[model samples]
Target: MGAEQIRRWESGALAHAVTDPFGQGPLPWLRGSEHYVDATGQVVPWYAEPDRDRGARGPRTADDVHRQIKGFAASGAVAPGQAIDFHITVDPPQQFSVDIYRIGHYAGAGAFKIITSPRLAGIVQPAPLAADRTVSCHHWWLSWRLQVPSHWAVGAHVAVLTTADGYRSHIPFTVRDDRPADLLLVLPDITWQAYNLYPEDGRTGASFYHAWDDNGRLLGERDAAVTVSFDRPYAGAGLPLHVGHAYDFIRWAERYGYDIAYADARDLHAGRVDATRYRGLVFPGHDEYWSVPMRRTVESARDQGTSLVFLSANSLYWQVELGPSPSGVPDRLLSCRKRRGPGKASLWREIDRAEQQLLGIQYAGQVPEPHPLVVRNAEHWLWEATGAGEGDELTGLVAGEADRYFPRTALPEHRRRILLAHSPYRDGSGALRHQETSLYRAPSGALVFASGTFAWSPALDRPGHVDSRIQRATANLLDRICKRD
Candidate 1:
C-alpha cells in the first residue's frame, strides 16, 4: 500500500462493525487470559487504565517530558492553589541551578530584569545520581507558584540555568499581568528527512537502531534517526511539533521574544497553516529540505520585513511537497530522493534569489573531503572586535573537521550585497572544488550573514558560560533587523 493508504488506515477510514451492537455499557479490553497480575503483583484481573492521563506515576525515563508537564497542571492533580511543578529527566543525570528573572519594558526604561523566584540565590549544585550506577537517569526539576504583582508591564523572562561545568542554558517563559495566551513557536519541522545518507538507506540495519556518531542508541525498530516525533502520524493533529535543531533555536528565541511561534513545514505545505502571522521567520540549523510552499512563504515574508535568519549552511537543498494522504496531518511531505534520481527546481536556484535579495550566498553545494580551514577576510565583521585579522588567528569553531564554503557569486545588478565572512575554499588541492560563504544585502535592504561554515554557533553548547561574542553578534543581528524602517 502507498503512504496515503497507510494514513487512511491509521485515520479509521476503514472501520469494522462490532458484533455486540446491543451492548448496554462500555466494552472491556479483551485479554487472552482470564486473570492477570496487577502492579502490586497480586492476582487482579483488572484495574482502571492507570489514570496516566492524570498524575498517575512519576517519570521513569528521559522520554517523560510530556508526563512531567502534565503533572504541573490542575487536570493532572496539582492541587488547585499549589505551585506548578515540572521535571526534565535525562540520561547521565547532572545537577544544575537555574534562576528565573522577570524581564519587561517599564515605561521608557526599555528591558530590565527583576528577580522573581528563589530570591538572591547562588550557584545551586544538583543532587548526584548513585555512585554504583553506570547507566541510569538524571532528573532535574523546578516548581514554583505564580505570583507577579500588578503594575508590571507584560513581557518575557529567562530561566538561566548554570551547570556544574559552568555551562549556562537559557529557557524562556512569559510573565503576563493580564490574560494569558499561549506562546507559539514557529519551527521548521524536518524530522522525517533525518539522515544525510547517499543511497536513502545506506546505514539502515535491522535488530536495533543506533544513532551513528553520537552512540545515543534510539533502542527500537521505530527509532529512526529522525528527531521529530513520528511514532504515530497526526497523533497531535500536527500541532507544531519541534525537534532537534529547531527545538534549540525556538528555546533561544523564547528567551529573547515571547511572541515567536512555529508550524511544521508539512502542515504549511498541506495548506493547513497560515505562516504570515509571525513578525519574524527563523530558519534554524541545517534546514536543507524545503517544500515549494515553504520556500515561497519564507521568501514572501522576508520581502515584507519579516526578518529571516538562516542560522545554517547547505540549506534548502531538496524540493518536496505535501504528498497525497488522508490523515489529519500531511504525509510524505519531504520528497527529495538524492540518489534515487534528479529532476525539477534545485535549491541552488532558491539560494541564488535569496542571495540577491535577503540572505546573501547561493549554496554552491557540499564541500568534499579534506576540509579547508577558515581564514578571515578583511570584510568579516566578527573579526573587528576580536582584533584577530587575517593570518593572525584562526576561528574557534571548525566545520566538518575542517571549514567548508558555499559556492557563491556577486548579487545581481543594483543589488546591494555584502560578504560578511569567508574561508579559503579549494578542491582538495588536486580537484577543482571551490566554495565560499558570501553575505549580501538585498535591494529592499534585507541583510544576510553567510559564513560558509555549517558549525556557526558551536560555542553555545559549551558547559559553563555562553560565549559573550557569539551572544553579542546574534543579538546585534536581531536588533538590526527589528529596527523600524
Candidate 2:
C-alpha cells in the first residue's frame, strides 16, 4: 500500500475508535500465513524475513514479570519412556500426582493411560517469567521423574498433570518411533510452539510474528525468540494449527488401515527416521520452519526413491536449528533468527535455498475468502476416485495461504509436472492471484505431490468444509505412494 493509502487506513482506524470506543462495531481482519507473492514469483521471497533495517531491537527482557499460577500443577516435555524431571510450581507450593495419557487411538475410544505416578511432594516460590526464555522456567522445588510407557502408540501424547484440587495443565510430547513402514507421517510440533503466546501477557513471551515492546509496540523480525523450549503447555486451542490442519489426515489414513509410522518434526531433523526405508513421507499442515540437516535428509530420501507428499502450503520456508534446553536434550529449544543477523538466519528462501525446489511450488499469497479448488487435469491418476473433471470446482478448499508453481523453472527436473488445480481468488487486499495443486516424478523415480493449500487435510472431515473429492484425491495419493509404485 502507498503512504496515502496507509494514511487513509490510519484515519479510518482513528475515526472508528472515536465512534466505537468499546470496539463493539463490526470490522474485518486479515488472518493467517498471508504474505507477498511478488510479480516475479521469486522462489525465496524478499520478504521471507523482515527487512534488516525495518524494526528496532527492543529491550532484551520484560520490564515486569508475570508470576500468575497460584495453584498446583506439573509439566515437562519428555519423550515416551523417558523421565520428565517434572516440576511443581505454585505459591505455598502443593503436592500432586501425575497421570500420563496417550492422546490418539487407544483401546476403546479416547486416550489411554500409560503411567500414574505416586503423589509427589513440593513447595512454591516466586519464579518470574523470563522474556528471553519465553517461559517461566519455574524451578522444581520437588524434582520428580515420570516415565512414559514404552509400548504406547508412537504419535501425539499429553501428560495431564493435576492436583486433587483440580489445578492442571496438559504437557504434550511425541512418542517418536523408528519403525519402518509404508508411510512416515510427521507432526509439526516446532511450528505449534513457535506461534504459541502461552501466558499471553506479552511481557514474558510470544511467537515470532507477534512479540511486543515495552511501549506495547509490535516488534518485527527482532521480536523473534532465538530459543524456545517445549517445557510448557500450549495455550488456548491446544495445538490449534495441528488439530485444524493436520490431525484429520491421521484419522483418515488410520481409518482406512494404512501402515503408517509417526515422527515429530524434531525426529526428521535428528535423522531418526531412515527415510529410505519408508516408501512415502507425509508432511501435514503449516510446516514453515525447518533445519538444514532436515532438508538434506528429505532430499536424499527423495533421491533414493522415497515418495514425498506435502498436504499443506508454505512448506519448508524458514530454516531453523534444534538445540538443547536448560536440560542438555536436543530439540528442547527451537532456535531461529528470522533476520539477516549473526546467527543462522531462519528464512531458507532468503538464503537462496527456495522451498519451491523441494515442494515444486512457492507460497504465493493469502486469500481470506473461501473459494473452489478448480480441477485442471481431471484425468490424472491422483483424481482417480474423486469424480472430478475439467472445470469442476471443489468448493471452499483454497484456504488462507496458498502455493503456486513459479512457471519459470522445471522443479522436477526430469519428469512431466502435472498441474491439477488452477484456482483463482481475491487476496485480502482485493488483488487477483491463484493457487496451484501439483504432482511430479523425481529423477530417482520417486513421486512428489503437494496440495498447495493448508486447508487440504482439515477439509477431509470438517463439517460443511468437508469435500469427498479432496478425501478421495488424498486416498489416491496415499495408496499409490505407499505402494512405492
Candidate 3:
C-alpha cells in the first residue's frame, strides 16, 4: 500500500499502536491522505503531519524539536479537489504537536468540511468549538485539513489548544474565508436575531447562531437556556417573525430559477471576488450589518453596471472590521448610528448619505407596528411588472411605509425610470412608511425594493395563507435582472 493509504488504515484500524513506522504512536494523530507507498518496500505507517487531519494525533519526538508541518504552495488559489502536500518539518530539538479539528461544522452537522491548517470553509461549523496546538519558538503552527463542501458559505473558526508544561490551553481562533468582492448575496454573519443573547459580547460583531441535537437537524433550543439572542431591535419573536421573508423569497426565486450566491460583506471588502464573474447581487433577510469597504465595493460594482438587489433594509449602517479574533466571534466595534432613538447618530453617515443619493433610500426609522397592511404603488415599474392590483400584502420583515424610509429627492438625476414618486393617493410614502425596511433605486439599473411593512414572507406559522403577491413580484424582479442576457 502507498504511504498515504497505509497511514489511513493504520490511523483508523491500527490506532493506539505504541510504536510503528509511523513513529512512536500513542499520542493523538490525524492523517489527511488515504495511502502513500513507503521506501521500505513494505506498507509502513506515515507519521501524522501538522497540515490537515480528520481523526488522529501527532508523532512524538525525543529531542523536542522538528519541523512538523510546512506549506506546499504559496499561491492563494486552488481548483476544487486539487491535491497538495503539507510540507512539514520536525526538529527533534524542539517538541511539536499536530492537531486536526473541524472548523465550520463537524461531520453530519453541515455540508462544508473545514481543516484549519490551510484555511476555513463555510459560514458556521459543527463542534468547531476548540482544538489543541503546541507553542514552539514562541510561535505555534496550527494546521487543519478540510474538504470543501459544495456551496460553501465562507466564514470559519478554529479549535486552538496550546500544550506547555504538560498542560493544555484551549482558545477559539476565528478566520474569514472571503477572498473576492463580486457576489449577489453579501450575507454578514447573521444568526444573532435567532439567539437569546448575542453569542459574543456586544463588542464582537458576528451576529449569527447555529445549534443541532442528536439527529443533527439544526436544533433551535437544546439546553432550555437561551441558545441565541440579539443586541437591541431583535429581542422579540426571533427569526420566526422574519421566516415569512425567507420562505417567500426562496420560493419565488427558486420558481424563477436565478443564479444566486450568498456572501458576507466582509468578503467584498477583502477583494476576494472577481466582480466580472456575476451580473448582479441580492441582499436578503436582515442585512442590517455593513462595513465601509463593503459599501464601497458594492457601490463601485453597481456603478460598473452590476445590478444590485437591495432586498433587505437598514443596510450599510454599522461599519465593521474583518480580521482575526482570539475569542469565539472576533472583535466587533460598532461604527454606525441609530438613525432614531436617544443616542442616534448616523454611524457611517457618509455611506448612508451615499446610499440615499445613489439609491434614493434612507433609514427613515423603525417602529413596533406589526405587518398589518400592504400599501400599493400602482405606477412604479416594479409594481407594474408584478401584475398585482392595489391592497396586496407587502410582506415586510421590518414593515413600515416605504416612502417614509426612501425619499424621492434621494433619487439621482440619472435614473427616474426605476422609481416613480409615491402616488399621493396612497400614504404618500409608497410602501407603508416604516423604519425596519426601506426602498430606493439608482438610474444605473441598480434597484432597491425595501419592504418597510416587514414580514412580507407569507407566514408558515399563520393559520391561513398570507399575502404573498409582493413576494411573487420580488421574485419576478430578481428573475428579470439576474437572467439578463
How does candidate 2 score on lDDT?
0.63
Residue-wise C-alpha lDDT for candidate 3, range 53-90, written one tens digit per residue: 33223322111011112211111222234322221222
RMSD of each: 18.0, 12.6, 17.2
> Best candidate, lDDT-wise?
2
| Model 1 residue 450 distance off true place after TM-score fit, in angstroms | 3.3
Q: State which candidate has the highest TM-score.
A: 2
lDDT of 2 by residue, 143-187 (tens): 565565676667656554545443444455566667778988888
Q: Quick one: how many clashes does candidate 3 have?
A: 89
TM-score of 2: 0.77
Those runs of model 2 whose alpha carbons end farther than 4 Å from true positions after fitting are 1-81, 88-92, 95-99, 105-144, 215-222, 237-243, 340-345
Better of 1 and 2 by lDDT: 2
TM-scores of the candidates are 0.47, 0.77, 0.48
Q: How many clashes (backbone N, Cα, C below 3 Å) per candidate?
A: 14, 2, 89
